[model samples]
Target: MGAEGWRWQDSWIFVSLVIAGGAGRHRRSAATRRPEGIRLTDVLATADHLNRSIPERDDVLGAVRRLAGAGLVTVTDGWFRVTTAGEQLWRSRPSSGMGTTVDTVQKLLNRRCQPGDTDWTLDEDEYGIAVQEYIVRLLPRPRRSPETAQERAEPS
Candidate 1:
């Protein structure tokens, strides 16, 4: 994959798929870990081998959005599955030299948008805004309201 079209997170997801043997979803519990499936976190962990840092939640969401936008995959019930086109793109990738790039992303899409196994997919823009909101939620809490602060300062 080239190093321009995709955000880094997208490459991580694709490479994770390649590494995980086409497992679409990550197993949540170690006890549930299967030979076929891998954890999402482990995807990031796998990226580490490529010298790519694991993405934060927002980046992961963005990657998923990009994939969905291209109809390469679908996100449903909190899982992602590659479509037939996604599979082709995955297969087309060189055995070595993976990078994040628009070209790479396009290669993943391969100008094909196929129906996926998932029941749902998100609109890229809406999903992006939603993920931004989620990131805001993750930020540290703001200072207490003036009234609450005053009351607390006054007495128990």
Candidate 2:
């Protein structure tokens, strides 16, 4: 998987959409054989909460478009559902390395975004900051500790 091609936020938003789809209740719609997929609003709301980024509709839509192109999700009207490939993607756990951002995000997602889950009691502001920090840590740049920054500033 060329996950490297995708921005961290885009990948996170895609997972958020998948979780939202799984959590949606199966409502029958006469026009479509499949059950009512998750609403775009709901998915966007979840992504905003998880990433604390409050991404523009276009941003989320772009991610959705990419996922659709990859056959990871199917969209109709304003609803979305995960395809078989999406399920596989979700099940493929990130490599487990202690203290790694990927592992932490994976654990958090599993704990809080399970299918059919409805219990979320986290403070919105705090959770948002937490999500933001987690995403920042996943960036490819070398992490610079505060002490290291201070030492660099203090020339010999």
Candidate 3:
């Protein structure tokens, strides 16, 4: 299965994985957090890190865009920063609930879309994205199952 669907999350160290090991390293608290904006190499690095058997760069990009669009991230020239919004979103989530599919979509999105040359204000189009962003935030798949094994186990 691609990174797009539900998969086993190493529940033992879920927090570290969810934030891509960047959350705690960058912050003392949510208020004090600053998400480094997008760096091409960084996104590529993350893409490589998440590059599983399935080519789900699209999914990963979706995740980044959601985070960035939601005010969770601030993408500047060559650097990506996660803002307070991001820390809050990541931290507020339950450590052990099934992650959301919306998150999977966002991840893919992030993997694909690079940050614009300058900082962007989230607009109406982005608002639509934010809706997905919020849903994805509410639930992050890959971090947890988006669906059940039974769903996949059964043949169509």
Candidate 4:
């Protein structure tokens, strides 16, 4: 299918498949290796880890079905693997940021409280603090350039 048809969930699932060994081995190792596809259970685990929330089984299955229909992935004996087309599509996907840090942090917080009591809910101030802490923990600090490092070493 065209890249235009891909959704964020679909892309995430595709990536999971690829990381699970869907793309097979490198050219140099192809002769000595065989590609192993992932099972639905494994995919579910991966989704849980990535999304930080348990996803509906049907939702994941639907995404896999769409990918199969597009010839981007293949299924055999309950295992799923990415096709060459899928790899190509993955490589060509836009590198732009998909969402802001606050949005992601909020989603994570929401998931954490989904099954808990009302007392687990965060107040506005608490939520803001949580978001800030998560963002700081999640995003990497910038590195100094070589020129800047040299200048700092030399002092003002």
In terms of TM-score, the best-performing candidate is: 2
Model 1 stretches with alpha carbons more than 4 Å out:
1-5, 21-38, 95-156
Model 3: residues with Cα > 4 Å off, grouped in runs: 1-21, 25-38, 51-65, 97-156
Instruction: Provide the clash count, candidate 1.
Output: 7
**lDDT score for residue 70 of model 3:** 43
Q: 27-99, model 3: which lDDT tens digit per residue?
A: 4554443344333333333333444222133333444454454455555653556565455555554344333
Candidate with better lDDT, 2 vs 4: 2
Residue 2, model 4, lDDT: 31
> Which candidate has the highest lDDT of all?
2
**Model 2 misplaced regions, further than 4 Å:** 1-4, 23-34, 95-156
Give model 2 RMSD, 1 decimal. 16.7
Candidate 4 structure quality by residue, lDDT tens digits, 60-147: 5555666676667777765677777666655444443433322332333233222111111213453345335544555788999999
Q: Give me candidate 3's TM-score against the actual structure.
A: 0.37
* Per-residue lDDT over 1-156 for candidate 1, one digit per residue giving the tens place of the 0 to 100 score: 122356546666665544544432333332434433433444455545555444555655566666666666554554445555665666665444444433454455434332123223344565455445545645899789899889988965
Winner on TM-score between 1 and 3 is 1
Clashes of each: 7, 0, 33, 0
Per-model TM-score versus the true fold: 0.46, 0.50, 0.37, 0.49
